[model samples]
Target chain A: MVSIAEHTPAPGRAGGGRLAWAFVERQTNLWKRYWAWELVWLMYGVVNTLAITFIAKQVGNEGAASSINVSKLILFLLIGTLVWAYLSAVLDDISLVVTWERWEGTIEHTLMAPVPRALHLIGMSVFGVLHAVVRTLLIFAIAVPFFSIDFGGANWLTAAVVLAAGSFSIAGLAILAGVLPLLYPERGAQMSFMVQALVLLVSGVYYQVSVLPGWLQVFSYVSPATYILDGIRGGIIDGKSVADTWRTLAALGVFGTVLIPLGIVTFMVAEQWAKKTGKLKRQG
Target chain B: MLDELPLRAAGVAKTFGGGFDYGRLLPWRRDGHAPEPPRRVVDDVSFEIRRREIFGVIGANGSGKSTLIRIISTLLLPDAGEVRIFGLDVVRDTMRVRALINRVSADPSFFRNMNALENLLFFGKVYGLSGRDVREQSPRVLARLGLDWEQALEPMSHLSRGQQQKVAVARALLTSPVLMLLDEPTTGLDPRSKRDVQSFVREVREEHDATILLTTHDMEEAELLCDRIAFLSGGRIVAEGTPVELRRTIAAGRPLDEITMETVFMELTGRSVEEDEEPREVLAHG
Candidate 1:
């Protein structure tokens, strides 16, 4: 017989808060607990930078077209690689938080909070991208001395715009990825794998979009990373002015409008499905 | 009688299905076959939890006690009936309803790698509590739950299950949430920790004007802490009343003071939670 006098410790808002600064504080605290993850990320960045430098050298030696300027190409490739990392980092965190809640049975807490579920995902992605941005900046600081590379045209304004647009797109995709974790939770790796596949093949990561055949080129157009990488490359490497990169921003903004609504709707529907299916109740 | 009920539910039903149907085609599914008829997890559960009263809910495993809590918390939408929290429709005014309540489950997952302060601070922020308020009130809640402030910075994993559970209580109290849905809060605690928590809950209600809905299978917990209890069996409330009223009703000839809820549960359901003595450990897995 359980006695009220003898009983002990006890614990939901499924995402209910608005996109509040206070909510972001909740996310920031979560990020702090996993410091070892940051060190691992630093190692990943170093290995990744080395891998791109090696690959760019190979492309130069093999006489691949698109101008085999070794130093510039390596730097450009590294920049492109870092951008991909930044975007995926945001998406990864968003999806993983959903997965984490499912695994730990903590989603109920978030669901019960007085915030929208989308705000939680958006808040998570924003912080994740902020972490990635800071990490990329650190990598640049380290690379500048070791690799003896220039920071390209010092137009902080264009860099800022590109970064802003890039983060917005990644934030959008992060919500999309976050939705998949809620929808197809059993298919754990599938959500992240698809996000990575979209980044690696469709975006100009290892290869440029123009290099692809026409059929594959269509996919590149749809990828947010393609516009993001192209804009970054134009502004930083090619030293192209704002007029030249307007198309990239316009494309990204359009993608943002479509994805933002679609992502939110999909998430709401997926959560509704979860409620309808009693998945949240069952799991919690 | 129910004019100002904090929570009210009537004929609330929930069904589960659409599982693995993409591969195995549902016959009536919009995309394919609907597969099989969905099994009802929560079936026609009707009850009202009045404001500022501690309502105890007792049920066997798989009897939908947790599901009922989730539906009340607005984490779930019932298929058939309505739920209103603080006179607001749960479905139509979900955002407001959420603000009025917070649930604490059996195995509450605080950030495992974080310290007690960190998890509480994080949750305080989630409820839109100011940093100043969290900074001021967090230690107070922890202290009220018998947590040691000097050891507040230790990683949660290092804390005993009881201590961690205390932290969970502190976190829920951050909002001073009016309606607290506690699901088997003391399931794994040592006896002393259990006593501390139960007493703390009484204090919360007596001092803060809070209404509580606690789910448990412990007969003593229902008798001692709950003002009224509803015996749940197979997703239905078999019986409900004040502690004394319930005992008298269950055993008509027996003196109320001599009656036990375990006896009531046995008489009504033809089964008892104590019979399942396999001791379900609240295992902590990532």
Candidate 2:
């Protein structure tokens, strides 16, 4: 006869922050438990970054570098790789919110909890940003040693500001992608990755957006990644201040303002649809 | 005003996959074919459980027991009718209602790689309890359910099925929900584990003053644990009362003690406890 009242804390006792931190704690614990998977992903990111950066090295060594600054080329490609790594990590973490729950068969339990859905999404987004930041930093640290890169004039504050603004918009897109798995359990996760691939194709992860076809360039206009990359490149390689990249920062701001709310609303609507169609119980 | 009743459902109904096919509007998917009609999973069901009572809804698999539980748990919306927990509408006041209820499904859904204590701590925090509270209270809850603390510290995947089920129960109790929805809680457990869970459920109600709505196919388990029982067949309650009263309905003037739940189930639902209903395909999109 345990006295429940004596043991159970009142609901919403500490406020939404503490409640939201629960997800962060849970995800961290999960990462710890699956350290092997984290190591594998980290290794893959490292190799991918190196392979792309080596193209500049190859071009420089092949006597095609008399006119081009090989160091700047390396830095350009390195920024692209590192930024994409960070952005994609955020995208992957948030988009897999539903996939992870379903895989563990805990979607029902999680949905039935007393917390507001907004808090839940925010919590996951926060974890995504934090997790991506740490991983991206590690990738940067590892890749920098291999290149004789100059960072004497880099405006890191501008890059950081651009990244912060860009992450919100990416989180919004990830939330939208997450709705796919809630609605179509069997193929939704794969569908989410396809969305990421589309973003990659349109956003010029490793090349200039201007180099893409005119019609594809129209998509680049709407992609937050396009602005994010341009802003970061201007800040790091060209050493431009935030004031110099106001237009790019403004574009990301608009995206964040529109997409975050849109994503949350779409996700809520999809959740209702899932409930109506009995999709929540389906694990696949 | 209805807060005194821990649980209540009125004319609750749910149908899956009966609507116009919006997917057909797609250019590549314009095949002219009628959509499948919606199938009623829980039809016009109604019941109530008083505070501190262990109420059971007994039916075979696919008889809508789980669907009903889902509705009450706020995991699903009823197509028609309403459910209230502690005077809160499950639909309109879902978050508030959720604060008062917790559910245990047949599958002990958990993070397999994480240990049980970690999982419990996560769930507890979601319900607004601090991690320190969960850590301090979990050992006692686990011990009360006959689970060793060492076993709970191991990853959930390494634990046996029964042990996993116990962890599920422990997770639910950690929230200290006033209304406990146990959807086939003892399903797939060994007999001894089943008894342990059943006794713990009883102890929960007595000590915690909780109202419990449990769904099960095990008639004997229902008889042993439920204060009152409802016979659910084809998404409706066919008969409901105390065990003796339910048996007496089909007793035909014979001694009530001579009646078995199996006989009552057979007379009322026209099927054995082990029989399963025909499966139906539920469309994910309508």
Candidate 3:
């Protein structure tokens, strides 16, 4: 017989961290197996980035008399597209947590494992952020050559801070959306996609939030992406320092602090409801 | 001292469905439709398993076999009563209970695109085993269960259902759970694969000193592998005893050898082992 002593897990926090990493490793392996799908997504991301960035070039050419600097406009749209891509990737990965489990018919097995739900979610969030970073970097690298963008005055530190904060806040929102599939399996995944669409519309991924109608602009105040885009644009376009974007940074900080724990709590509550309602069972 | 026991469930019950219908408030003048009433899927069930014993709950489909298993596995909450695993409340000490138990369901649930070794390593790590330990142990477990290492390297979707089931069994055993919940582990296996799993289950109990709670509609399987059997009908245990004792309950002095499990099941539940009950909405809200 294999000795239980030999296989017994390390107790407490250390073990919890390992359990969380297990999800990351599992996701990596799954993605490796689904390389073709990843390739398709990457191709689509590149095409989408190029398509949006080219619009600035078209407007710059068509209206040479206008104040819009062709190179700066292209850079502005590029930043927006790339940031949206990263945010969308993170959101997609995190929000599909339940959907992926259901698709693989492993929802029960994964949930019933010895790991705490919090750690499991944290692991998933970590993977989502990492996966998003890599995919966004690739899209940025491929799309950069197509535009005459300048970065000599770019405030890299401020942009990094904003990106990190925005990722955390978006993770929380994704977790909230993730429970949709757990709560409504038949239409839950589509509901999550719709949540992402709403975020895109309100957050001004492709345009200025100020351009939105006053009623719609109110939502931009609540969206982490609004601050993310504004701060990133300020950093990359005008080279604003961290001190100049303190308000945006503070807002993102508040969002991250509040939404992450809120997401975890909501997920736990939804999990209990799923258990009670038998919604945890695998469904088509 | 209660912690020394392998499993204990007391007056456990679960019901599904029956909530206010918001759809009824829709504006269209329509025939009023009431919400479906709650159905007791597992009604006041209680059972215990001793250390290293193979206890079976045999029932047809929708008899609450899977629900009882889910409750014990800590995947679902009981509406009433308590389940204690090694004296830890399943609800309160869920993490600790989960550590002591692992389950295999009818579906060999997995990331179908990933190879068996990858899946096992992932599950093993979730249960706190290191990758190196899983790598060292999983091959041995798989080989013992009659799965080749080459086969274990193929994507799960590429493997036969029986092979995939073997991988599932290996994943459960990989954790070295003190209590193994096999919820119809052999339901879809081919005959040879079924025998492979059955023998492996017996081997696990004998060698690992693991207490097993298995549910199945396979009468012969229950008779062959279970030290004691409980006949479940409509979310309740209709009868429970050793195979011979269950047979003798309705034998009426007939030679014990002449009584088969099918006959005992027919006598006890008033239905054939092959019969399925009215399908309950297991996934519906309560």
Candidate 4:
């Protein structure tokens, strides 16, 4: 029999595009196998949204209904819950970049491969964004019917633009949080949830940032999710055009532009530290 | 270019467990206490490998064989020294160096849910192999290692340890890397699987334009496969030569055929390679 090594080609250099697409493809294959988990999360999001949005509908009084602006109240809760759901999903996916590999016992093999660090992450971020969008859209599809939502005046195109821009910053924050697991294997995974929780509270997932204490308002300004929630609400509820929410959109763009690179660099540094400290192989 | 000598290590050193005072965490700790001394894992070690040569590093557990392999594979950096692969510095040209090498660790990792073919294809793509090439090459490689093509479709979690190891070897070979780092490639294999892997290693050295740096504590395996062997004890290369040359180190004018590798190891390290008779306590140093 002919030897397999005879047909083997010389080792080739990894281009960022090909490697990134490979990562995307790998993630897609994984999702195909475990799509039930995604459906479960989608159902959970729908139930969570309905439970929160119905708070305004529960008060059975004309005076309370008029004072509450029940329609706007539901919209607020809808946007708040949906945006929070999307942002958290993206964060969770990207942050698990290392954790998933660790869980699968493939961290060393994957990390030691010849692919560029940026492409590896960009590919994962691409999958995260795509996965988050699909689940969020499904939740939205199942959700709008529960309420008499009026999309006739809603600027959905602007909302999508805001979501796209805002996703980059969330991607950056998730990459930063992902380094926590690489750095502190024992407690890092849980600590990442704390970071997400802080963002949830400060970004006004359920209430306006104005309602937060004076000190926390500073964090709200720093969190790109705040602008995402604001811009998305403006587009979907007020029917504001892209120009009307350009400032928030632009802020998100700037956040994505800066944080992505910053997050990558921070993660790389932490990775080096982990390897040096023999923490790379740590599994829980 | 950069193909004459496949591997070279110059005064490589790595240390662990120093820097901060962990003892101070105790409730009865006092001030002005110094931290524990750093333990050197790979202590000023250096060696070189020629192209297409199978060089083996033999040592007991915790002798820093894996650490040395990691340093050479560019997975871990040397604290104080240089490692060059094919005339390229492992640190300076890490990406290029990585492209030229592939490693098969003792316990290989893979996507458990994915079949062998899927894992191999994924790894192949990461190493810049085309999908078609991966598909064509994976089966043949697995067959050479005593694994059937049909069995390669099963999820890795369902496969036996030996079969998974064969898949790991297949994945490493799929890329046709210039240098192959095998960290105890046949450490826990059955006799047949061990012989299968050993035969594949010989075949790779003969057919592929590759240099093999293997680490193992198995004396017979090293003798049969490696062109030269280095006995690493306590993170240092205490003996280095071909099997015959190593045997002659303590031959004492006796016939060379009477000297076994075990005798050489016993005379050099004053301990049997077998684990049953050894003490259970592990020292801090590598």
Q: Report residue A186 deviation for candidate 1 (angstroms).
A: 1.9
DockQ of 2: 0.59
User: Against the unseen true structure, what C-alpha lDDT does each candidate score?
Assistant: 0.74, 0.89, 0.89, 0.84
Tens-digit per-residue lDDT, B56-114, candidate 3? 99999989999999988888899999999889899888888888899988899999999
Across B1-286, the per-residue lDDT of candidate 4 in tens digits comes to: 4546789998998887676766698867757776656777787788999878899998888788888987877778789889888788987788778777889988878888888888887899988887888898887888888898888988888998889888998898888877899999887888888888899899988887678999998999999999999988778788999999999999999999999998898899777766322112324564
lDDT of 2 by residue, A211-271 (tens): 9999999999888999999999999989999999999988899999999999989999998
Between candidates 1 and 3, the one scoring higher on DockQ is 3
iRMSD, per candidate, in listed order: 8.3, 3.4, 3.5, 4.7
Tens-digit lDDT track of model 3 for A183-204? 8999999999999999999998
Residue B284 accuracy (lDDT) in model 1: 31
Which docking band does candidate 3 fall into? medium
Residue-wise lDDT of candidate 4 within A1-284, one digit each (tens)? 23323333333544668888888888887787677887889899999999998886764244577643787888899999988889988999899898889888888888878887888899999999998898888888898899876667789988999999999999999999999999888788898999999999999888999999999999999999999999998998899999999899889989999999999999888877876776777363
Docking quality of model 4: it rates as: acceptable
Give every collision pair in model 3: none
Location of the lowest summed lDDT over 10 successive residues in candidate 1 chain A: A2-11
